[model samples]
Target chain A: MQNNWEKLNQELFTSSKRVIILSHRSPDGDSVGSSFGLYHFLKKFNHHVQVITPDPVPPFIHWIPEFETAINYEKQKDESFDAIRAADIIFCLDFNTPSRMGNMEFAFDRRSKDAYVINIDHHQQPDNFAHFQISDTSASSTAQLIFDFIIKTKGKTALDAQIAQCLYAGILTDTGSFRFSSTSPHTHRVVADLLETGIDVNAIYQKIYDNYSQDRIKLLGFALKDKLKLYPEYHTAIIDLSEKELNSFQFQKGDTEGIVNFPLSISWVKMSVLLTQKDGIVKMSFRSKGNFSVNELARNHFNGGGHENASGGMSTLSMQETLKQLESILPDYKQKLDESKI
Target chain B: MQNNWEKLNQELFTSSKRVIILSHRSPDGDSVGSSFGLYHFLKKFNHHVQVITPDPVPPFIHWIPEFETAINYEKQKDESFDAIRAADIIFCLDFNTPSRMGNMEFAFDRRSKDAYVINIDHHQQPDNFAHFQISDTSASSTAQLIFDFIIKTKGKTALDAQIAQCLYAGILTDTGSFRFSSTSPHTHRVVADLLETGIDVNAIYQKIYDNYSQDRIKLLGFALKDKLKLYPEYHTAIIDLSEKELNSFQFQKGDTEGIVNFPLSISWVKMSVLLTQKDGIVKMSFRSKGNFSVNELARNHFNGGGHENASGGMSTLSMQETLKQLESILPDYKQKLDESKI
Candidate 1:
């Protein structure tokens, strides 16, 4: 299996140039991270490499290597889409389908006619547009596959501080600093490999995880104090932020990033949601514990599907209307939770 | 040194009936942690144990084992002082002189006249009040000494989950999760031993460090956004909070905890200060990098002394006056920082 992966990687690298790596919309730590990690790897081999995302990198994502280089097509009106059109190979990472790319789907489709699209992702299934799809759902992050690629195909000596830092960021954020259930001994081995780079792990941790703006923290405080809504019997938690409240707090693009995770801390709360108004659309994030599949719930009810533990969607309806829909379905989830004794 | 400490601890444990374990005034993570660690240890031996503090346990100190049981003499008006007066042993941990005990000095002096006072602390210098003093300034925390006592005297087999949790808290906070300069191989060994008890390491980390109330975070936001005052040329950062702001934010004891460390991230800043109003006393905390000794700076300038990197003190002047003083002395420290080229 390992030899086959190396052969495939070698073939892909040899035959391709002007490689573009892409991740999902609203790129998170994993998607942005894995995409950038691959971007750097291709750059090392003198390939004309670029990483493009649908949305701007979030503030928390700023700590990752070469984040400033990630061009958001929406922001760069002058960006030559010619790079994508001229590319020989386009690598799509951390996502399965073109629709998951949001507005980037058009560019991806247009470029695929000229270039062989290689899907190197850690998600279920693959888009039919890809000629070579290396989708491993069992892998925690696409970066992990890239790490194996660097070691097995390239060489362990190829792993530099920059690459190690990028990989570490992906592994650390995705595993919640090795606290999440997804973490395994393989994750520790990856971390141990990164630590061998002598990257001053403490400073990196302080910079990435510990550092936070007082205003963002205050915004969180205000949400919890006045806006948090909890349904104890239903074991559900909800937090809402209107555009006016966000504006008043001078909210940055990524200010509400991890607010959804806070609610799940309540021992009884099996699921959590954070509803916010962004660009005139009501954005809702769903998170769950145990076997409660937020992706299934969001995809079936709202127009969204993600991992089993987390999912997100946008609604044309007002938050009030969304709450009514949620209220109707919450009782069924509560019953399921009770039956599972969670 | 080992034989003497072991003999003293053994004698105290065997003869003492009602023992009082006292931490420092304005108890912090290490002080309260060591106090509670020893409290739980003595309780396991079926000794009558009462943990005492001069003031209330600071909010950040809740990570200590059985911290809820710590008695605040300042808050308890109805409780008899006679209970302390009749104790066979008084174990003073994490403090040296009675002057540092604040209001508890009167009670401590009265109780120790007939009792065996064993001072088990991790501080510089000592007074002649105690019959036995195990004050090793080299130790990261008194809990480190307590762990040593447990291994050499109580035996390694005596360690259990609760005791391990307490000891882990002490070592973790004092060493900044094994990132600080004081962190040694012995600290790692202590952590390894704690893990042997099957205590969930991640759970303890989440409970202590990850547990953040939104309100406190908001207060932090307000401080950074509005309260931050910096001498950019001096590479000195200061955040001064007024009593009115504290009251409006509903500031508790630990509201500004770890707030001082944020400013040091800016590459230019060599030192930082967090000044807040506590009972009208200008409470100032200092943090520094490299060889800049905040302990000496705090002691000489602000009536505070602590480790080389971190320290605190109280000022008789108002918060505004204190800020003024800090600004006046800025140029000297600025020159020092420049000389260090840090």
Candidate 2:
């Protein structure tokens, strides 16, 4: 990517610069991971680097090294503005356009005219918004891309345990712990290289994925115990949670994020659906394992569309009515669902 | 491991031999995956290979290539015996000693003379029974060992999707989907190489891991809902099921096998225990992550022991009493348990 390595190295990486490492708003594992992984690597090059985020790092990601030091534009506007004013180079990671920064876009627009922005992302179709970009939609995560960047620039010797753990966290979460189709052979190889740095893979996995709230776990238990209904013949499962029941568990916004995918662990379940009712509307989350496209199901029925395996929909009907409608529609897709899991 | 490559090539691998691939009793993912992976590889050399298990490859393993073709020593004694007798080279896989064959030890004992046995396993303290042995307890799984073996002998070109899937299944299961500490960097590298063969990793993962019975899932729900108790201060959780509760779920032996490990998924939980009262006694399963040693705990208090992370015990006390005792003992170990998960 560096056609003029000497010039870019001298200007961007060689000499000490006030580099601001920036990620998308509402930062996730990949964004935080890629940002700090690059941040740590840059620190080795004697760069005065400061990682900045649009929001605070969630508790699940607090285990990452120096995560608290990352300047939050929303939380510390004056400091973030000061950091932006002092920056010589800015890194746009895990997101394409500056619009992905949401309310933090103003912070980016305030960067000095001389500030050089290098984009590193895996999301498809980046906006024409950076001085240099390394975009590969095929990459499992931006963390993996950042790994390649470090190896290409400074070679494998530059990676240390801290950088490895951050990257490992990124790839592990984004790739669904190496279970998703996005996890390519190179992803595993990158993980192998990362593991060789003496990062505890098990610990990284635990820190990223295992930080569940007690109430959230209890809600999961209740959902599985009382609401889950399985249809063996149709190879389908549905779990419906009412607003009342959710309140009983003190449900928050993201409590049901993964509940729909859980039933996919059942061998016969080709398609799993979770319907959560709040504010008189039922929201549906669909997850399929093998070949059944929840995207198609969501588009053809409900006014929603997303990925092939995971999709979302909404119904104005009651949860019971929604379940009834879904059950009635199952027989039509039974043939595909029967073949989906195999 | 092959000191005399030329000799081994001529005598063991190059020439067509009636190759009998044998694994230990009660075939698991590692045993079946290793045996059949080697089975497919040996076929390239024109060796007529018959994979034999001590019993039927369980329903869970039916997805592996030629798993059904694997002669079951228990179900088809004559076929197994005949295969053993006709063998010119016996590949002992996934087991250290012949005694692990259980009742099928006779089958091994009856093998024809001049049948050179090469033992390939990862288990510790392999018996001095085979002419050649590659036992590395450090290997994550026999599947990983087999991958190394394949690469050593035939080079990367020898691996195909079938062989890759088989070995992938072995490593995936043995390493607990790459979460267990046994999963080394080399293990991930081996998987990377396997994935290079264009195997459908997602499908393989689904086939091997998603095959759960409906009753088993329901039982898991019941346990989590009605039996589980959490001690956040001690970083511990426990689930206990009485005989009546077990009966209500139509309990099977392995239904509760991994129940103790579930609580460890919560980030703060260092130790998790499952106490199931069946027949006349309460059986205890203890699992802890990070530094805590459940083996010592089990051995000290419950007269049982196993590995550092997972162990077992038995109690004459009622489920309630066992829970009380465990809760009381946890306070004494709170300091360690608090530090255990990190």
Candidate 1, residues A1-342, lDDT tens digits: the string is 122555466655675477777778878778877787777776788787888887777776677777777788677623626567777778787788889888777777677465867777777766555767777777767777778767866887878788877876776677665455454435545655665665555555555654445456557656765677878787787888888889888888877878888666555667889989977788889987667788878898888878787898777888788878887888767766665433
TM-score of each: 0.67, 0.89
lDDT (Cα atoms) of all candidates against the true structure: 0.73, 0.85
lDDT of 1 by residue, B44-98 (tens): 7778899888877755557566777777878873352655687888888888888
Per-residue lDDT for A56-171 in model 2, tens only? 76777878898877888888999998898778999999998999898788988989999988889988778878888888999999999999988888899999999999999999
DockQ of model 2, rounded to 2 decimals: 0.62
lDDT of 2 by residue, B115-138 (tens): 988898887667889878888999
Instruction: Name model 2 segments beyond 4 Å from true.
Output: A1-7, A231-235, A250-255, A277-284, A296-305, A312-342, B1-7, B231-236, B241-257, B275-285, B296-306, B312-342
